[model samples]
Target: MHSAIPHLIELQRVDHLIVAVRTEIETFPKRVREADAKLSGARTAVAAARERLVNSQKDRKKFELDVQQWKDRAKKYRDQSGAVKTNEAYKALQHEIANAEAEVAKAEDAQLEVMMASEEAERRVRHAEANLKEDETAVTKERKVIETLQAEKKQQLDSLLAERERALAPIPEDLRELYTRIAKRHHGAGLAEARDGQCRGCGMRVLPHTLQELRRDPNEEIYRCESCGLILYTLEPVPVPGSASGSERAASSAVNHS
Candidate 1:
């Protein structure tokens, strides 16, 4: 009975490793996907900024073409006015020239507006591009970190699995079943310590008679915490608050009551 508790404790330790590694392995992909999503958003910003710059340039080009076409029309009208003989014809041609000049002015104003906006558009594209590059680098670094972590966890998983099998070798079938069921119910933590007449798992005060029985058959008897249903193991002579021996305190803290 004295040896059984150590075996169970050892089994629990191995199980903990297995559970932790498995959790990390499962969540790693989701973390990577989230990072990828951020990268995609940054890239979209760069593309949108570039598109704006291209559209602005296209608008400027169209305006310039319009200005040139109106200017040529005005010149042709002015030349035709020279060839006109009647005052009515001359006045009509002058009016046409004025209208053509106004069209040219409108086109020029539009061109100027596009030209003014082009600088800002280009600046935005550059800024977005820089941000994209930075985000890409960050994504790459995060991917590498994930990969390294996954590899390490994979190695650890294999080792833990082997250790778990070994840990199971000494336990009987009934205890194993109990351990498995309880562990599943308690997030892979099947056992808890009873200390200072209290169940550490659920903070329930253990009865004096039960505590005495637990001390008598600490390893042989299967003592369970009534409140939490965790298999209980006792550590006698609870450490004092300010005692020189801090080992028990440290052990208690590390115990996975949760």
Candidate 2:
């Protein structure tokens, strides 16, 4: 690894977290809206049910009035039957009474139908009102959960931004420019770990000279992957278990697995 690679790696780490936090925060509003929509839908259903109930009540009242009118007409015809002097006039009065009675029966039937409709409307209003309370409670809980996650992600984003600034502070301007350009193309991964002669970022084979240069302790020469153009780095070897020199490892185990 070059002298400046560590700082860039740190910056990349912060940038990745920042991107993740911002992406997660972006979803919070939609989730909140979904929760609000459920509540709004419940409220609309209740309103519609109440409106139906009200209209059904009005219709029942109108049918009741119609039934009363037909009853009154039948009563008037019966009263007039006594004043009829001729057989034809009395028969006409009887016919009128029969017609009025038939109308009364029809009106009563219509009124009964309206009353049944009103009962159904009342039942729907009750059912809707019951669901409305549950929707309200569920929306409140969902909103609270979304809002809490939103706040937490915002805090994480803020902290990452500050840490990014600190990580950027130690890096040189040229390195920062290079890292930014490269990271933009690679989703915040500006550097690749060089291990087993391969670029970990892109799975491309690393050149022998570049790998050799990177394996040097306190390396100063900056090298990039020929295939992917990402700045390359190599991890120091870990000591084998119970080795005499804790600083070195066996040939087969000379690797930074982490």
Best-matching candidate per TM-score? 2
Candidate 2: segments with Cα more than 4 A from true spot: 238-258
Candidate 1: stretches off by over 4 Å? 205-221, 237-258
C-alpha TM-score for every candidate = 0.77, 0.86
Report the Cα lDDT for candidate 2: 0.87
Worst 10-residue lDDT window, candidate 1: 236-245
Query: Considering only N, C-alpha and C atoms within 3 Å, which residue pairs clash in candidate 2?
Result: none
Question: Residue 26 of model 1: what lDDT?
Answer: 98
lDDT digits (tens) for residues 1-258 of candidate 1: 245677788999998888888998999999899989998888889899999999999999999999999999999999998899999999999999999999999999999999989989999999999998999999999999999999999999999999998989998888889988998999888888888789888899988877777677434678788999988887685345667568666778789564
Model 2 TM-score is 0.86
Clashes of 1: 0
